[model samples]
Target: MYEKELEAILPRCFEMYDFMAEHVEQLQHLEAMPELKLRMAFQSGILSFEHGLSSLKLIADGFTSSGFALMRPQYESLLCGFWLMYADTEAWFNKLSTAGKVSPDEIKKLETPLIGVMLKDLEKSNAPAHILRQLNDFRGINNSAFNSFTHSGLAALVSNGVGYEPKVIYDSLRNCNAVAAINMQMLSILTGYEEAMEPVRKMHHHFVDCLPIIHG
Candidate 1:
């Protein structure tokens, strides 16, 4: 029912969440300051989001690259990644909506309902409904954060560009950073108990341990 490697990895996720939060707070403070600080905060905020997104993708790729081996590898990484992507995209959509640049139809076109997407995938894969429900709950939390950031109404602050005051930018960045942090936390939970992950983790490690040589 559990895996050891996942246990080893769970703490790392928590650490990442805390680390991301510190940056989010810093960005928040910087947003209220002068242009110089604002630019820096925005850059940091953007970089953080990018990093968070990359991390999610990497974790997902780890699941997909192992030839879909159920024992040696689990697709939980991909599952979690989908959840995060769903959250991030929803946030962007909300932000655009708050800015009055997008209509409800436009928002609908975006992947706002990530939980449903994952559930659909699970159903297709014939995975356990109970587990899928748990994943859905996690996705819901991330999606909520996305909504919060977008709903906070940071569009005007962004439209003003780099000239905006640090304080305003910082506040906006706080929302951005919070979403990123939440994504990291979700990843941690998914990967928290390596024993839960079982042979899948070992299989993944084995693949990494063995790399095929390429000749030009």
Candidate 2:
């Protein structure tokens, strides 16, 4: 059953994987100032995209809950990376604080100068409208669903049965592809890799074409 579903989407998955691998390699060749926040965010996005591919492969192998659990963080890495691209240094430190990478004592010193500012507050002031819209879309469409799996909620348990459903596998692949497309687009913009544009657009169209719609 899993094999059948995997065989059906294998071609599309391979295409997306190849495209992402090529761009990831290309990204390594581009030079950006070491001090630039966008560069770090772009790198993080790339890493997340790679991990997301691994999760998708697990889904193909019938580890559906595990794959779904990985999706939220993958989405976060992309969202945070893109958000940080336009944020200031203070926002950068704030992010680290939010992630608990910074100690409370250290965050205290950092926050002294940035007393009331929060990452959410910076969104409107720093990020572009389109970026904000993308973040909102992810929150609405994927975030909640992904969270249910990540947190071991009822949705995750309900889908952990023995059989593999083709629609389930296809939807998982589509979600992964969508994230890859967004990650590539963000990297291209930040790294000035205009060559990625055509491939990313093609990938996006593939996702749109393959999406399943429910008629009520």
Candidate 3:
């Protein structure tokens, strides 16, 4: 039963996975030193997207909870990476400058800014209100919901012992697609990968048409 269901979803999952890998490859070619922190964040997000793809494969193979659990960190990496890019460019660079000699500790410290702090910084920036609202929705709703799956919450428990359902698999695919699309978009913008924009835009449009509502 689950095998048949898995067979049905594999095509679409593979397609999305291919697109994500291509985007990550493009990101790899980017010169990361100028905006090192932002670029590293984008790279981390891309890596997480790859992990999500692996998890999607697991879900397709019927390891539902295991796959769903991976989504939380995957989504966090995307959002946190974008927040680092969006919040304060000057301040990020300033922090790096003040650190004097570049060390692993300094790099790790730069990446340690809390999402809450990033959001607050973003809110105070000159960015438009709609973008802020969208990010808030992502953090409050989508991220919170994804976290539930990892925490052994009702979402994780409810599907246990239930036989295979196509809806569950489809939902997982949609989520993986959405996260990958978002990560690609952020990486393109942050890395100045102009060539990545067309595919990113296409993926964004497809996601808007088919997936659950996730602002930003």
Candidate 4:
């Protein structure tokens, strides 16, 4: 794997994690909302952000394939959060609330839309246009890679088998950072404190080098 090569990038990756961690900590206390939908939306975004940070740790330690496997969940959580905000009428949230006390099998029976359905639903729900555009672009570019990583396809086999370059690790880290930024921004929105997001914007621009947008 990239055991030796990882050293060259670990410091920057760690810094990115710390920067995001700070934002997460700040957002957590600020997202106090009694509204059920907003609370759930904030929680989902936090989950996505956690996945990004966890993936960074795994990738930094040379577990690139495992790290990548986390990306799809990260993406899905963020998507679901938005879908909750716009597409849902508290139905799914209610189902989830009750499912918490139900058996695992019963919980599995909960009606949740697949990714395609969610996307279509979101479009009609007036989901943020900027987010929709970014999501479409991100998925169009990375759908296959996301599947490969999560499903242990050829891409995962290759990364785990022969290993990859340090730059690949850097790119992966940056990609995770991109999702983290999006999640943090979404959390900021939930906070209803425009000033809370000022730091988020600053953090994003300050570390924009790690975002995929920089590459494009």
- Of 1 and 4, the candidate ahead on TM-score is 4
At residue 40, give the lDDT of candidate 4. 80
TM-score of each: 0.25, 0.74, 0.72, 0.85
Evaluated at residue 16, the lDDT of candidate 4 is: 70
What is the TM-score ranking, best to worst? Answer: 4, 2, 3, 1
Candidate 3 pairs with clashing backbones: none
Best by TM-score: 4
**Tens digit per residue, CA lDDT, model 1, 1-216:** 123443344344445445555544444443423433223324433444455444434433442111111201122343535433322334544564565566777665543344355467555554445545545554454443333333442432343343333333223222322344333333333333333323333322433212112122
Error of 4 at 97 (Å): 6.1
The lDDT of each candidate is: 0.38, 0.66, 0.67, 0.78
Which 10 consecutive residues of model 2 have the lowest summed lDDT? 110-119
lDDT of 4 by residue, 1-216 (tens): 554544655676677778878877987887646688789889999889888888877876768899989988998899878887889556667777787688877877576677778888888888888887777666676789899999999988987899777777766676667777788788888888888788778887777666776432
Q: For candidate 1, which ten residues in a row score worst on lDDT?
A: 64-73
The list of candidate 2 runs beyond 4 A from truth reads: 1-7, 31-33, 88-91, 94-123, 126-128, 162-165, 205-216
Clashing pairs in 2: none
Q: Which stretches of candidate 3 lie over 4 Å from their true place?
A: 1-9, 89-117, 126-135, 143-145, 163-165, 204-216
Runs in model 4 deviating more than 4 A are 1-10, 94-104, 214-216
How much RMSD separates candidate 3 from the native structure? Answer: 4.5
- What are the RMSD figures for all models against the true structure? 19.7, 5.4, 4.5, 3.2
